[model samples]
Target chain A: MNFKLWVKPFENLAKKDRFTISILWVAMVLAYWLITTAGEKKFFPTPLQVWQGFAALYSEGLVVHIGSSLWLCLQATVISIVVSLVIAYSYPIPLLRPLSRAMSQLRYLPLTGITFYLTILVTNARTMQVWVLVIFMSLYFITSLLAVIKDIPQEEIDHARSLKCNRWEILWEVIVKGRFDYVIDVLRQNLAITWMMLVTVESILVAAGGLGVLIKNSDKFMNHGRIFALQIVILLVGLSIDYTLNTTRKSLFRYSKFN
Target chain B: MNIQYEEKDIILQVENLSISYGEKVIIRDVNFIERNVVRKEINQGQVVAVLGRSGRGKSTLFRALTGLVKPSSGKVLIPDYSQAPSNGMQPAKEVEEGDVGFVDQKYTLFRHKTIYDSLTFALRKSGEKGSEKKEKVMKYLIEWGLEKVKDQYPNELSGGQRQRVAIIEQLLSSGHYMVLDEPFSGLDIGNIQNARQSFKLIENGHDLNTIIFSTHDIELATELADSIYVMGYPRLDDGSLGTVGTIVRHFDLKALGIAWRTEFTQDHLELVKEIKSAMLAS
Candidate 1:
């Protein structure tokens, strides 16, 4: 009965999606338990050991590191979104088209290679890291948003104009409102990149105190349990954030439920 | 053909309207005639259908009427309501909100907004506020049998429902005139009939609203339009094909004793054949 109750929620999911998610979850947990317990070399710590490490870090005030990292990611993401919107919307204008096209090409440049130059350009390490992340995220964001904007139906713009909408009104009504779902989807897709760069930047700037710094400190002491715990924390945090964004998108664009 | 309505009763006029894209002319020298009078004007509350085959510039004519496509040489005239019209006609470009409403082939609706909100948003844009807007929306929702789907977003509705909503939104926003571009293309017979009924209800014998729609369906045009404008490519006097699309035939269905709600008898079918042949010949 309890199994039936628990499975009821998943009944609405597509059979294939349900199957995929169930198999992946079970396999991941099984592999984690088996590999940690059966290993003689103690290469991977047990789940209990990792849990103990998490508890210790939690009591030692790990929230500060998590909060700082989240704050920095939030700031960079907001800036990237604002800048990308401006570039994507204005790209149709002849004067701005070349600049937008040139900036979009920057996505092909590796973030790691650019970080070296960015560090030199900005004196402060933390500021440099943020700028590097902003640049990387903004380029990705601009390209995705431009593609979304391009896909907006011409009929929608014409419809708005027929309703006496001027250029600015058409921009707000058709371009912004029509592409809103895609915008949210783009943000969700690029968020993974933002988290990846956040870890890389924080780890490289060793003086910065963040989740990446915590992981680095654990690595220095050769504490596999703490390292695994911090890794798990980052994974969980990233997953939760992604889940929140998905929920937000679904809730805000409830009409998409039919689609 | 010469069709005339009183100057005060006419809502729209197209005067030697021609449209072209750079070196290519899409439509040229298109004109409509009043059945009796000398003035070539579409009377208020009259349904006008532009009939043509695909790519014969029916959609282009509609676009020019809506001012989306600028006319190459001539002008589309709508009555200017801002001032007492000196000539009873103003250029189509001068037509604003509350003057013309257009529904394209896609039946475009705001996917994010509910049917109720879509109506209210249009009203708000036209400067309506508060209880008046809500009252008007509710009244139309019930009148159109869309009350059940009032709170549902556009995507949740069926195609016919969405089309109805689009029509109602246009009617509420700009009631004076409407141009529907191929509104019956993908619809089933039942929905098409329902759409016709909706158009009839809006026109309502009051001669206040005017509608112009384009369709390739001869039967539909014969049934719905008070005056039918057949657009096609014509042979030019220079012994070469005319590049511009022009009105090849203009006639009033009522004047020919065709009733709007009459069954499709053999006579009606013959009329349809004649129109089809005329369309092809042009």
Candidate 2:
């Protein structure tokens, strides 16, 4: 392979070459970390120490904590997607335009501040956590979904109209059914935010005993190894979710995978 | 020699139409009428081509004709099916969106649906249901030579296949009039042949079907259209090109006795030269 091929901008490699480069880059990062942290395994704990920490976490029921986090994320994903789709799809309605636009802009607000009001409104800790995540994600989700609807080329809508579809049918055929691939794409993108907020929200309600609680407990003891280990777990789980969503999108709407 | 044909009552009419974006006039006073062209013992649809240079508002005129864009001054009228015909003439009504089939250059399709599903969805508003709907869609798919690829998604088909499917979709939904914007643009020689062949196939589908298309290729326009409209900026009293676009010249190939010929002739080349000269002056 031409080494220069790797640095060329926007270059697309064959699947085998692409996979080879990915593994090579990951190995380089591992090598760099192993070389740098050879002596002092103090502040930045070594991977071996982190592995031991991972083993310790497993003994302390890490699987259960992970299951809690995944469950919370899944619930928020489904609910937020439904609610966000409703708000975003309502953007074409003149009367509901303001409500949709307002919801889209709500993504900018700091997440923690809203939890206070939410706490007073909803008393149950678990329900409050779920609501907190749902609100946090729905805002970003709505913003993304609305943008997808807005960026739809006028040609597609015109094509739909030429097919004798009325206003409501146009909304259904063009906006909702046509671009559904992007919903899964947007979900994959916002799932990262969902996982990050999972830690933050779960930290608030310790009774939930999620990965966020484990993170909080690790922070209290200044256990850098355990925190690092939990971070890896979260990263892997997040990657898996992203992979699943991307697969679903590519399989269902085969056109979406087109370059 | 090609067989004789006669023009009947007006099928599509554009009267005193003008449209502007804010204060910038795009197309002004654009008027034309397409009558159903009936060949002796043969089904022949109307093929009206609009030829113009870039920025000449051909696209705007097409959008107006298709009722996708409302004109500022005048209206487009087509035969209204809601009412009965009188004295061999159909009643006319102002055209509205969904009244005309529009096939844009890209031939965009619903990304998620297969070709078969997309065509069925197009017929949903037609009120045809059960096996009848399936049979109708299947008939078009087979006639258009898209039966094998009917199960494929838009991404899986070639460009020409997608174009055929797009045209068939519009035909199934909106009965007759089809406005194709830049249909010949960017097509290779073979693909252009395919596109024209498909256009002829659709005409074979219905005698009342009309195709209004735009293209920059003057020679192709002369060969394909029985009636041609040349859209360009008009000359003002100051002897300068005006900003607004209009029909600077119209070519009735039928009157010239050069339409629907199997081969391009010297007369067609002469018309092409005339059109090019008109475009240059505009």
In the range B161-208, model 2's lDDT, one tens digit per residue, is 889999989888888889999888778888899899988987766779
**Interface DockQ per candidate:** 0.50, 0.78
Query: Candidate 2 — which residues are off by over 4 angstroms?
Result: A1-24, B1-3
TM-score, candidate 2, is: 0.95
lDDT of 1 by residue, B1-282 (tens): 223343343456678888878888888888763321122342237678888766778988888777777778777776556566455543234444335788988899887788898898778665676888999899988998999999998878887888899888888777667899988989998998888888877666345577789887888788777778888888788766565689988767656756454466665677788889878777
Q: Which residue pairs show backbone clashes in model 1?
A: B2-B34, B2-B35, B3-B34, B3-B35
Task: List clash counts for every candidate, in order.
Answer: 4, 0
Give Cα-based local distance difference scores for all models. Answer: 0.78, 0.88
Candidate number with greatest lDDT? 2
Can you tell me which runs of candidate 1 are displaced by over 4 Å?
A1-21, A28-63, A92-97, A110-121, A218-229, A257-259, B1-10, B33-44, B85-98, B125-129, B236-244, B259-261
lDDT of 1 by residue, A147-256 (tens): 87777788887787777777887788777876687787899889888897766778767777889888878888988778889988898889988888888888988875
